[model samples]
Target: MKKNLLMLFTLFIALFTITSVKADDKPVKNNYRIASDSLFAPFEFQNSEKKYVGIDVDLLNAIAKTEKFNISMDFVGFQTAVDQTQAGHADGMIAGMSITDERKNVFDFSDPYFTANATIAVKKGTKNITSYKSLKDKTVGVKNGTASQEFITKNKDKYGYKVKVFDAADTMYASLGTGSIDAFMDDEPVVKYAILQGQKFETPIKPEKIGEYGFAVKKGTNPELISMFNAGLAKIKANGKYDKIVAKYMGNEASDDKKVDESTMIGIIKNNWEQLASGLGYTIALTLISFVLALIVGIIFGLFSVSPSKFLRGFTKVYVDLVRGVPLMVLAIFIFYGIPNLIESITGHTSPLNDFAAGVIALTLNASAYIAEIVRGGVNSVPTGQMEASRSLGVSYVKTMQRVILPQAVKITIPSLVNQFIISLKDTTIISAIGLIELLQTGKIIVARNFQSFKVYGLIAIIYLIVILALTIFARRLERNMK
Candidate 1:
């Protein structure tokens, strides 16, 4: 009996020791907030489904999983992401940052998980230089303020290349395609993606080692987090998962000189745009819905602005003063991001607001303030004789305005309404801040894919110019008809 008791006590102690050891080895949950810009595709972007799904995002998730931590992401702008980390809004930035001395002073860096190779992409069926040494007097495009830009400028005498710098890689690539520039330099993946996609005019050759890309932790961030992330990255690389994800997006053979066709690319894009044309239904739908709401709100306040009663007059003035005083950007941010969060806290229901709803609400709220002024002007423009004539006929005050004053106001309001409607249409772009995909959003999506600000967004600007011009013509015709 004594021997059996000793054996049982040993078994229990051993089991408890093993369990404690396993628990201690497991990582703690992350529970950290993060932010990044919505560019850097195949790495970090808000996809069509509005989810942040990309290679960088995936790697970050893997790290969090390995480190036993949780992180929620804020899809802010890239410049904003950098600022946020510097200002301590986020703990770190994992947005395909390269460790440069200029950036290194303010931010600490993890080990380079990846290095971006440099390449010169040029138009199709063109071979000017047989060797790197043969290159001289070539006009090249490099992204502004990048190392490559500096390289091109500094070595202009050495390489004999005249460099044209642009704010975006996409525009730089597009210029290469259009022959606006002879050669372009950019990160390997971005250049390759453009080549594969239809900017086929340019192809990367010689795939030279350019710069190192790493994750950035803010200056003075927790060193333990950096160590854990570095370990997690190593594990992924060793396990073959890292290579798979890279191959899936960037292609298996980096050196394979794939040529893209012009016709096929255009056709594929046209087909996609045909589908995207249906997306305009949502755009128009929101515009019309919001226009009506704004019109109603405007007319109510407009009447109150011109009200005979002092209480009603003062109330309208206060409302006008408040909404007009607040910036549209601030209001949209508050309505879309702030209001929902407030509601969630109070009700304990994380009510998800649809992007369209938030955008429409913002547009309406903004337009109504302007519309009220337009309406008040229209109402005041009506002859006092007209109101008196209706009143003399024993009609009520409401009836006098509806039957006599408003009819005349309609003719004058027509021009103002058209202008107001145009303003509302354009202002919907601001809702992109809260994740709404309007026309500007569509342009940004294209810009992200192609990195061509000129060809991509410039084309969008042309489309807008044509659209607004057509609306102006229509408005003028309507005014003439009314006159």
Candidate 2:
């Protein structure tokens, strides 16, 4: 009887173990991912320790805890973060962005996360231009590829001012601090936050309503995720977490009523936008001029490198190596500032060329180096046997390259050549460092006077994306043809 009872107990234990193993075979849950660009300040910005930490991050962390969903965060450029979400590489994105009607057609967005009035920041007590109207004919800076660019570009004729554009707000603001820009536009709350954090700039330039910031996800994504996010956002707002985050960043002006000074802010917007609009013409012109120069220089240098003469080949090779070795920014500065100084010293006269010419010269010279490589690679791609065959047929060397080797080489290099065109297109921004008016420089002047970071940058981003996308498509087609 004891042996039978022992056997029964062992059988019961084995059955329970089998049941538990079956339950464990169910699928495990995964945390969702979100992407953001660390640009919007207070809401988002890189901390002193050089880590991305902001109200946006803090809020998201709180939401994750409450929602009980795994949350992963990744940093990319704001627009790029949107692309990742659209591509399903990320579950969502939340930087301080506006929910413009145009964007609504493409992506799902959360309700307005926060509101900020646009205001301008300028040096403490500089006078020639107090407001946007006064900015006429004065050099102004803006960050390229933002709503500010579009607004200024559309209204320059109406405003009668000149604008310069730069690629980044940090760079644009840097120029303003150095007095390179008269003023810039930005969100009032954000600018105030920057000022509290140690930015030295003149008081209230004026204020303008640019737009509000919103969170975004890919259009037609898992609605459940968006639902959960919206719910969590509501939870935070009701529990006072949102106000607490805002108050923590409010500095001494923690009082709820410190509105962005309107009159001063508006004046700055008028100045910066007027300047930005005036610069649109020159921006397009620079791209055309630099592109033409890059093409001519690229083709000539490429042919020289392909020449049979060791002297021609050696000279072109050195030129390509030297230019390609230097960064585009360094070359732009040298051409714009260094060359003119050298010329003045030798001739005892300042540069006779206009600012535009200096810019064109710098950008093209740098571009030619890469163009030369692209051109040379194309010429060399033709099998050596083809050149030998042409020579055997008694064709002149130049004729053989032009008719037989060159044609085939060009086909192979078309893609890189187009890329060179795009690079030259962007290289125009580098001209701003030398004080030349272009798309990017225009952005800085506007930002200086108006702190509409989202509205301003959103304008420039769309313009550049359009141009870059077109060039990319062209390159793709060219590659297909060659293949």
Candidate 3:
């Protein structure tokens, strides 16, 4: 009787275990992934407490809570977030993205949550730049791809001003302060936030035509996600959560002041140490890897250019000329965004090049051309007698070039090579075009959050100077050792 009773209990336990396992294996119903800008103040920017707390952040969280769905937020930059959403890597985006007809073709958007307008601002105490009429014969700045750019481009002819498009707000503001640009246009809230944070700028023009901000997803991919977002947003608004979020970040500003003051440069650096350090690491890694690749390519092509065969020399010439002719910025954009599309068109395969890898490859290609010329000059600078002596010593042509000529050429070109590396390091700033944030981009992110462009840029300039100086010192030591 005891044995029979134990067997029954074991059977019941097995059934229960099977039922629990099946329940656990059920798929998650409505998990959505979203992307937002890393810094776009009051809409989305990191606070002094190091938390990503702002209007967008709070609103998204509230929406997810009301909808009973899990959300994962990826705080990549604006361009990257758009790229990922279009590629279907993220379910949606809500980075204070302005809704426009052009964007609607590629992305489906939720209901408009906010509206904003572009405004013209200039440094204080500037002369005769009060209105659009005064902007004639002046150079104005606008952020790339923004409505401000469109506004400036459309009206530039009428205003008789040249427009310069910048990638980031901080850079644009810096240009205004330094007189590189006479005036600039950006969103009213952004400019107001900058002023509130002590940026020495004044908005002389009223807000321009208004645009609605919306959450977006890739077109025709996730209708359910959009529905959920819209439903939750409506619910949150009805329940007063939306109003609270807006007022929390946008109102009672003096009570919740956290902008960095003039004396807090050190504090800003200390507060954002992790971001800066990560950026430095990426910059160093990019520099070292790209330099190494450039060195190898330069040496090979340098040899080819100096080869006895006419065909080999011609090949090297065409390559060097073509690569050198194209601008680095253009080449980088092509490699990062265009290559995948080109590949897909030709082969019907969607292989997007890794952003960092594309950057390194572009840098390597550009630097290699210049380095090839340096290497050739270095080799030619060597006496012809050296190669003759090596050949007379029964050394093969290949061996003589490698064992006798190349080493001397490399040593002679060491200073130039180091300089080229430094140039390459600085050129990494342009790679931010394709969304790889190195040191400069990192500083831009911090400045966008804190609105302390002068201090942040000053600190970035120091960091860059220190790094290049260290490289210069090392090069000098190397030259001395060689001597």
Candidate 4:
């Protein structure tokens, strides 16, 4: 237990030292890491060639070219873009974000780049909902962290409607199609784009101007970036480039050519093989790294739980209980967003932890607690007589534990550990909330592009099933070998 604690302490210190060293390396000037929404069409979504090219993407690139500033855009989802920008992992963001007064507390905004309204959309041929009062008792959907969500939530009680929030626009649109939601509110352009793409939806109520969209950076950081964006935006609008860019995406002729026949399952698979393969790779890699770390930390804590010292056992108990009590999604968000904000508040410097590191740490913390209990149960299953016999032979307690106890405990725990690994792998889906593009998130991205929810999600499910079955077979074979 002491050695384990020492090793854990050393690991943390090493991480901190590395972070400090990197902090001293100055960031390149005028070269910014910009974050944008992955699935927000017209603003930002993939083209037919699988290249990211939307109004926001093209506009930002034009702005960068005009300003002579280098920029790299990360097409994570909207909520993730916000989180990344706030955490300083991204230098700025331009995700059709509304310039709400509330946001002014955290982000400094550029001049309004575009104007749009939020409208209530219902399925075609549904004549009932003409106003807010007409939506009484009906469920309405909104994407998370959007102006539409804020409006829906704030007026939900007054309108006597229930609200369902989705993580992405594609899912919310699907819900409306399936009647899971009677209606939904979203940006006018996005709803129109969906209609253009063959979605059977209509806007009944007059659209409300939610707010103008603006480019933003964390408050008090990168003032020059905002200045440059504003200056370049003015130039583009003056030179007629802004109107042309918007027309390219939203014009009457704007439509993606079908790269493949996505109607059939085989076609869907053929079209999306690269994305599916990449997502699966990320999922497997995250699972492998997290499980290994969890195994080490869990065994340490498990040993601590069984230690003779009351303090050690009590500390382990508290840790296991606390971590186990929190939900995985909540833990992930806290680790990714809350921790960085907390660090910045205290030390006045941004924490360098990105989504991947935060996700691994969250998964490791959650899995280790359950694994500690598994270890404790396995150790307790061994007979007390073995330890007594070893001690009677003049063996030290630590040596006896090393030579007799742990080996037997490991054998007993092997099955449970294998099961835990499988659970951890599935749990990686929850990490998508933190914006780590694991298997499920990858599916969401593809669905955002093709709107083939059934085929894409079905393919993802099959992939997961195959991987889990393989792992299960391997585990069974290992158990047979051990026997």
RMSD of each: 8.1, 19.2, 8.7, 12.4
lDDT (CA) per prediction: 0.70, 0.68, 0.83, 0.89
lDDT for 168 (candidate 2): 57
**How far out, in Å, is residue 357 in model 4?**
1.9
TM-score of each: 0.61, 0.49, 0.82, 0.90
lDDT of 4 by residue, 241-272 (tens): 99999998788766773656776789878777
* Candidate 1, 1-483: lDDT as tens digits: 999999999999999998875555444444666766566666675443335666788888888788777788765555546655665556677766667888889988888888877677777777785444445777888875456666567768887767788855555656766778887777777666555545565453576666787778677665555766788899999998888778756774432212222133453255336433543455667678999999999889989887778998899888788888887778876775567657856886545456578777888888888888888899999988888888888999988887788888889899889999888877766666655556666666555644445554555566667777988999999899888
Model 4, runs deviating above 4 Å: 1-30
| Ranking of all candidate structures by their lDDT, best first | 4, 3, 1, 2
TM-score, candidate 3, is 0.82
Pick the winner on TM-score between candidates 2 and 4.
Answer: 4
How big is the positional error of residue 310 in model 2, measured in Å on the Cα after superposition?
A: 24
Ranking by TM-score: 4, 3, 1, 2
Q: For residues 1-483, what per-residue lDDT tens digits would candidate 2 score against the true structure?
A: 999999999999999888765444221237767877545566665442234567788788877676666778765445546645654556788866667778788788877777746666677767766777776766566555455555556656776766778755666767787677777765677667767645677645567766777778767665556656666789999999978887776667532212333124453344344555556567667878877888898889888888878999999988988888888777765665566557866886545334578778877878878888888888888899999999999999989988998888877888777877777777777666555656665654344333544455566666677878987997898788777
Error of 3 at 307 (Å): 2.2
Clashes of each: 8, 57, 0, 0
